[model samples]
Structure formats: structure tokens, C-alpha cells
Target: MRAVVYDTYSQDLSSLEVREVPKPKVGPGTVLVKVKAAGVNPVDWKVMAGYLDPLMDAYFPVIPGWDVAGVVEAVGFDTPEFHVGDEVMAYARKDVVQGGTFAEYVVVPAKAVALKPAELSWEQAGGLPLAGGTAQRALDTLGDLDGKTLLVHGAAGGVGSLAVQLGVARGATVLGTASEKNFDFLRGLGAVPVAYGEGVVERVLEAAGGKVDAVADFVGEQLETTLAVLADGGKHVSIADGGVAEHGGRYVWVRPDGGETARLGELAASGALKVEVAQSFGLDQVAQAFALSQSGHVRGKLVIVP
Candidate 1:
């Protein structure tokens, strides 16, 4: 199997290489998936560059990716949940950095796998797990959004877009922060768009008619505005910034949860959620895909068709 691997941590995307590697063997309670598509996330590059070194362990020569949508080519012993030809998607992050989804195949625990929704394309399914689960986790931390006013920072990006739609689907009045160019995009997701930057608090206040009930910060550095516009006792969460914990808000780190991933798949299948693919790249373009994701300007997912 040909896979992308980086021998050492570095900021340069060129460190990633497509190399011929052994096809991963499945084990008990895990299944081997033939990769169809893999989603490129900022975390992929961040980890590759050693930004997460303190928090996680990394083995040399790591394959870089977590979000995958593929077909089950083989099931491991005692893995009765899926068979050899089932389509599946998973948040396939392991305990340590190695053997990721940016390859011809990945072996994921059966518990981390979900049957991909028939309504979603392979690209959409590949892009769904990580971002969708993150959005769901942040919302879950905020409690019930029904009839509440919710705000999302970075509402145009992958997780943020999903968060905006999920907030609306959960009956929240959603207000989102994005640049003017993406205002229409947010609005299409059923959110009231407020341009981010100077005076964002006032703009968010105006959009929400005052303080919002909860805020989910997808883009970091929104703590000041979040603190200013949150109603008394309002809930808040951030995925990008851990500093939120000091300010009465939680910093969320999404773990692989097949249950939550499947719930998101249901939402997409029911037409209550949409997964946007900003661009798709072939295996050799992994570096370019990583660069685009690192730009922080990608409106949707950057998928690698492997």
C-alpha cells in the first residue's frame, strides 16, 4: 500500500512523502478499510509540525490523517458489526501518532467505525467524522440548544459550518461570526452572520438582540468577545484555545466517538446537515492540501482522494 509519511516534525509540508508501505493487518475488534478519501485538517499539519508534542506521543515516520471514509476490505476476528464490502467512516485517531488514514488502507477499531450514510458522497462521508463530532461535542457541552440563542465563531469553516447548521437543527437561534465574503454562506446555513474583528461584540449583540445563551469558538482568540457578549451564566466552549478554561468556559478536545459520528450521519441523511468540500486533491498533492488547511481561510473540507 502506498501511504504518506513524515519522518520528523517540521513546518514544511514537503516532509510528507507518498511511500510504499505494508498494508496494515487487522486485529481483534478492528477492521481494515480500503481508503477512498481522507480529510485534511489543521491538526494534521499542526501535529506534523510538533505543535502538539507536549500533549501527545509521536512515533517517527507517522502517517498524517484522522478523518476517513472507505470501504471495509476485511473484518478482524470477532468484529461482527461489519463485513468485507460495507461502506464505513471513522474518526481513526489512535493513542499515538502513526498509521493514519492518508493511505491506501487504515485499520480502525470497530467501535470507532460507523456505516457511512447512503445519502452522502464518499468525499462528504470522509470529511464528516472529525468535524461533525467536534461540533456535536461542543454543543453537547453547552447543553440543550433548543429555543436558545447560540453563537459560533468561524462559522464558515468546516466544523463551524456544521456547528451552525446543527445549532439551527437543534432549534437554536444561531448567530455566526465570519468575514463579509462568507456572510451569505453563514446565512444559508440558517445563521445570522456578524462580521468578525473590531467591534465584533457590538455586532454580535446586535445580531442576537443582546447576550447570547451560548458561544462555540471554533476559531481561537475569541475569548474577549465571548466574555463580553455572553449572558449571565451563559455557556461557552472552544476547540482551538485552551485558555477558555480560565474564563469559566471549557476547551473541547473531540475524541473518536462512533455514536456521535453516526448521529451526525443521520443528520446529513435527513437533510438537516450539509458537509461542504472546498477542494479535493490527489495523493501527490497532500502537501498542497495541508498548506490550504493551514491557511485558515478554507471555507470547507480539503479532501485527499487516495
Candidate 2:
């Protein structure tokens, strides 16, 4: 099978290249998926650059992706929940960083795979896992958002946009912080838009009519603002900063849960959750997609179609 591999870490995209590699063998409780699409997150390039070296060990000739939407071609022993030819998606982060989703195929644990909804295109489904899971995890830490006011720190971003939509779906009145340019995008997602720089706290207060009931901080570095705009006794969480814990807020990390990911697929399929895919690239063009993610200004998901 063909895959994009980086034999070693680099400060740039110079190491990523497509090459023919040995096919991964299915194991007990695993499934081999013929890759239809892969989602490119900033962490893909970060992992390649060794930014996550202290956290996870990497093997050479690493394939670089974690989000996938594809069809099962083979099922391993004892995996009764899925069969050959089942459509599935996953936030398939492995315990070790070796095989990845950015190839013609990938082998995943059956516990980390969920049925992909037909309502989502492969690109949309491919892009949904990591960001959708991160968004859900952050919001869940804020407790039930129903009838509450919630503020998202980076509302126009890949994860932030999904956070805004999910917060809205939970019956929260959401206020999103973005540049003035993306205010309409937030509005369409059912979030009231607040400009993020300078007087952001004041803007949020003015927009929400008071301090918000809870906060989900995606952009990080907003500890001061999060505290300033949050109601007393309100909950707060951050995916970016562990410092939030110092301030009585929770720090969230996305976990690979097939059940939660499947729930997101069902919500999206029902039009209760919508994933915005900003662009698509061929498998060979993964380096270009990584460059776009590095820009940090993309409004939605960047996907790889194999």
C-alpha cells in the first residue's frame, strides 16, 4: 500500500513523502480500513516535527494522521461489532505513534471504530473525529449547558466552531470570540459573536448582557479573559492550557471513544451537528495541507482524499 511517510523529524515539511509500504496486518479486535479520506490536524505536523516527542515515542517511517473515515476491508478475530465492508470513522490515536491514518489503508482497534453516517461525505466524516471529540470533551467539562450562557474562546477556528455548534445544540446561548471577519460565520452557527482582541472581556459582557455562565477555552492564553467574563461559580475548561486547572477550571484532552464519535456522527447525520470542511487535498499533497494547518487561520477542517 502507498502512504505518506516521514523517516525522521524536521522543522519543515521536507521529510513528508509518499511511498509504497508494507500493508498493515489486522490483529485480534482490530479492523483494516481502506482509507477513503484522512483528516489533517495541526498535531500531525507537530508530531512530525517532534513537538510531541516528550509525550509519545515515534517509530521511523511514520504515517501521519489520526482522523479517518473509510470502509472496512477486513475484520480481525473476536471483533463482532463490525464486519467486512462496513463504513466507519474514528479518532484512532494509538498508544504508540507508528501506523497512522494517512495511507491507502489503516488498521484500527474495533473499540475505536464507529459506523460512519451516510449523511456525511467522506471529507466531512474524515475531518469530524479529532475536532469533534475535542469540542465535545471541552463542553462536557462545562457540565450541562442547557439554559446557560456559554463562551467559546476561538469561535471561528476548527475546534472552536464545532464547540460553538455543540454548545448551541445543548440549549446554551453561546457567545463566540473571533475576529470581526468571522462574526457572520459564528452567527450562522447560532452563536453571538464577540471580537477577541483588546476589550474582549467588555465586548463579551456587552454582548451577553453579563458574565457568561460557563466558558470553553479553545485558543488558550485566555485565562484572564475567561475569568473576567465568567459568572461567579461558573465552570470553565481549556484544551490549550493546563494553567486553567490552577484557576479552578478543568484542562481537557480529547480521548478516542468510538461511542462518543459515533454519537457525533449521528448528530451530524441528523443535521444537529454540522462539520465544515475548508479544503481537500490528494494524498500526495499532504505537505501542502500541513502548511495550511500551520497558518492557523483556516475556518474549518482540511482533509486528505486518498
Candidate 3:
């Protein structure tokens, strides 16, 4: 199978190389999937650049992708929930081989895989796992968003966009922060759009009519500003760093949850959740995909069609 492999951390895209490697074998409790598409997240590039120090235990020569949408080619012993030829999507467990989704095929735990939404194409399905899961976790960390006023920082990005849609579905009046260009897009997702930058707190507070009931800091650097705009005792959550101590709110690190993945698929299938793949690249173009993610201005998720 051909995949993008990197030997050392470097900011240069040239460091990523396309090469052939042996196909991974499916072990017990695992399912082998023929990769149709793989979603690229900021974490993928961060890991490749050796910026994720806490994840160093996973070792090197890693594949560096967690979101996968593919068809099952085989199933290992003890895996009864899925069968050969089933179309599935998953956020592969982070502790495992960094996932092998960048190749023609990869293996993931059966518990991590779920049926993909019928309404979504492979590209859209591939983009949902990581961002969708993060959105769910961030909202869940807050007790309840229904009838509350919510603010999402960086609302035009993958996770932030999903968070806005999800918060609206949960009955929250959502205000999202994005650049002026993405304001319309955010409003289309049922969120009030506020331009991010100087005086962002004032802008958000103005949008929410003085204060918001909750704030999810998808962009960590603006944590202080987000907190200042929230109502007293409002839920504050951040996925980027330890926001618990700073804002007196919960801090979350998204984990693979088959239940959440299946629920999200149902939402997509029912037209309640929508995933946008802003860009697509071939397997050999993984370097370019990584470079695009590093730009920090992607409107939606990027996928690699292998």
C-alpha cells in the first residue's frame, strides 16, 4: 500500500514522502477496512511536526490520521458487530499505530467503527469523525445547552462549524466568531456571526445581547476573551488546552466513542447534521494537504482520497 511517511519533524512539506509499505494485518477485536477516504486534522500535522509531546508514547514512523471512512474487507475474531463489505466510519483509537488511514487500507478496532451515514458521500463521512466527536464532547461537557445562549470561537473551522450546528440542534441560540468572509456561512449554520479580533469580547456580547450562557473555545488563544463575554457561572470549555483552571470550567480532550460516532451518523443520515469537505487531495498529495491545514484558515475539513 502507498502512504505518506515522514522520518523527522519539519515545517517543510517536502519532508512528507509517498512510499509503499506492507498492508497492516487485522488482529483480534479489529476490522480491516479498504480506505475510501481519510480526513486530515490539525492533529495530524502537529504529530508529524513533533509538536504533540504528550502523544510521544505512540512512537515514530506513524501514519498520523485518525478519521477514516471505508468499507470493511475483513473482520478479526471476536468482532461480531461488523461484517465484510459493510461501509463504516470511525475515529480510530489514538493509542493505536496513529491509525493507517493514509494508505489504501487500514485496520481499526471494531468498537471504533460504525456505519457511515447513507446521505453523506465517502468524502463527507471521512471528515466527520474527529470534528464531530470533538463537537459532541465539548457540548456534553456543558450540562445542557438547550434554551441557553452559546458562543463558539473559530466557528468557521471544522470543529467550530460542527459545534455551531450541534448547539443549534440542542436548542441553544448560538453566536459564532469567524472572519468577515465566513460570516454568511456561519449564519447559514443557524449561528449569529461575530468577527474575531480586537474587541472580540465586546462584539460577541453585543451579538448575544450583553452575555452568553456558554462559550466553547475552539481557538485556545482567545480563551480570556471568550470567558469575559460569558454570563456568570456559564459553562466554558476548551479542547486545545487546560481551560479548567483558567476559566473555572471544564477542559476536554476528545476520545474515540463508537456510540457518539453512530449517533452523529444518524444525525447526518436524517439531515440533522451536515459535514462540509472544503478540499480534497490524492494520497500522494498528503504533503499539500498538511500544508493547507497549517495555514490556519481552512473553512472546513480536508480529506485525502486514497
Candidate 4:
């Protein structure tokens, strides 16, 4: 199997290599997937560059991919949720040895996997787990969104895009910050688009008619600005580190939730939720994919097709 492998942490994307490696073996309560597509996320690059501390107990030469869409080629014993030949999508446990989905095959815990929606393509399914799950978790943490006004920063990026649609579905008046180019795209997702720049604070307030009920900062830099415009006692959440808490809001680190994944899958299947893939790369182009994600302006998820 050809997999992306990296040993050292560096800013350079070239450190990621597509090389032949032994295929992962399925264990009890696990399933082996023939990976169709793997989503590239900021965490993938961050862990690769040593921005986030890798677990000391885990071995090096890590394969850094959390979101995956693939077909189950084999299933482990005692797994009742799925069987062999199920098309599944998952966010693998961040602490696992085979976190690498940048390959032709990968193994994931059965509990982490969910049936991929029939309505979505492999690329779209690949983009959902991590970003979509994070968005779902953040929204869940903020009580009811019904009739509330919610603001999302970095609204054109992967998680923010999903957050926009999810907020709309929950009956929130969603306002989003994105570059001018993505204004229409954000609007199409049922959000009022505000240009993100020098006066983001004013723009959000203007869009919402006053202050918003809650804010989700997908872009970590605007934590203070978001907090300023939030209604008193309003909930604020962030996937980024420390900033949320520092701003007197909730800090969120996305974790795999099979139940949430199942709910999201149902929404995808029902055409209520949509996953956006901004770009696709072949497995051999893992380095290029990482570079694109690190460039900080990708409009949606970047996917590596194996």
C-alpha cells in the first residue's frame, strides 16, 4: 500500500512522502477500509509541523489523517453496526497508530465508522467527519439556536461552511465572515455574508441588526472581536486553542463521535446537510494538499483521493 509518511516536524510540506508501506491489519472491533478519499485539515499540517504536541506514548513515522471515506473490505468480530462491504465514513481517533488515511487502505475502530450517505460522493463524504463534527459539537454546546442570531468566523472554510448551514437548519439567523469572493457562496448556504477584514466587528453587528446571540470562531485570530459583539451571556465556542477560554467563552477540541457522525450522515442522506470540497489531490500529491491547507485561504475542505 502507498501511504504518506513523515518522521520530523517542519513547516515544509515536502516532509510528507508518498511511499509504499505495509497495509494496516484489522483487529478486534475494527474495520479495514479501502480508502477512497481522505480530508486534509489544519490539524494534519499542525501536527506535522509540531504546532500541536504529538502524544509521547505513540510511535513516530506517523500518518496524519483523521477524516476518511472508504469501503469496508473486512470487518472485525463483535461489530453489529456494520458488515463487510459497507461504504463508511469516519473520523479516526486522534491517538491511534493508523491515523493516516493518506493511503490506499486504513483501519478504523468500528465504533468510529458510520455508513456513508448514498447521496454523497466519496469526496464529499471524506470532507464531513472532522469539520462537520466540530461544527455540530460547537452548535450543540451553545443551547438552542432557534430564532437566535449566530455569527461564524472564517465562514468560507471547511468547518465554518458546515456551521453556517447547520445553524440555518436549526432556525438561527446565520451571519458569516468571509472574503468578498465567497460572499455569494456563503449566502447560498443560508447565511448573510459579511466581508472579513479591518472592521469585522462592525460588519457583524451591522448584519445582525445589533449583537448576535452566539458566535463560533473558526478563525482563531478574531476571538476578541467575536467576544465584543456577542450578546451578554451569549455562548461562544472555538475549535482553535485557548482563545475561546481567554475570551470568556468555551474552548472546543473536536473529537470523534459515532452518534454525531450517524446523525450527520442521515442529514447528508436526506439532503439537509451538504459537504463542500474545495480541491482534490491524488494520494501522491499529499505534500501539495498540505501546502494548500497551510496557505490559510482554502474556501472549503481539501481532499486527497487515494
TM-score of each: 0.99, 0.98, 0.96, 0.96
Q: Per model, state how many residue pairs clash.
A: 0, 0, 0, 0
Give the Å shift of residue 227 in candidate 3. Answer: 2.1
The TM-score between candidate 3 and the true structure equals: 0.96
In lDDT terms, which candidate is top?
1
Per-candidate Cα lDDT values, in order, are 0.93, 0.92, 0.86, 0.86
lDDT of 3 at 9: 68
- Candidate 1, residue 252: how far the Cα is off, in Å: 0.6
Order the numbered candidates by lDDT, best leading.
Answer: 1, 2, 4, 3
Q: In candidate 4, residue 44 scores what lDDT?
A: 85
Candidate ordering by TM-score (highest first) = 1, 2, 3, 4
Q: Between prediction 1 and prediction 2, which has the larger lDDT? A: 1
lDDT of 1 at 129: 96
On residues 1-306, what C-alpha lDDT tens digit does candidate 4 reach at each position?
888888777777777787788888778888899999989989888777776664533356777788999999988877767877899999975464434788889988887888998899999999999999999999998889999999998899999999999999999999999899999899889999999888888988888999999999888878778877999989998887465786678888767877789889898788778888899999778888888887889998999998
> What tens-digit string does per-residue lDDT give for candidate 3 at 39-138?
9998888777667766555545667688999999999988999999999999985564445688888998888888987788999999999899999999
Error of 1 at 4 (Å): 0.8
190-256 per-residue lDDT for model 1 (tens digits): 9999999999999989878999999999999999999999999899999999999999999999999
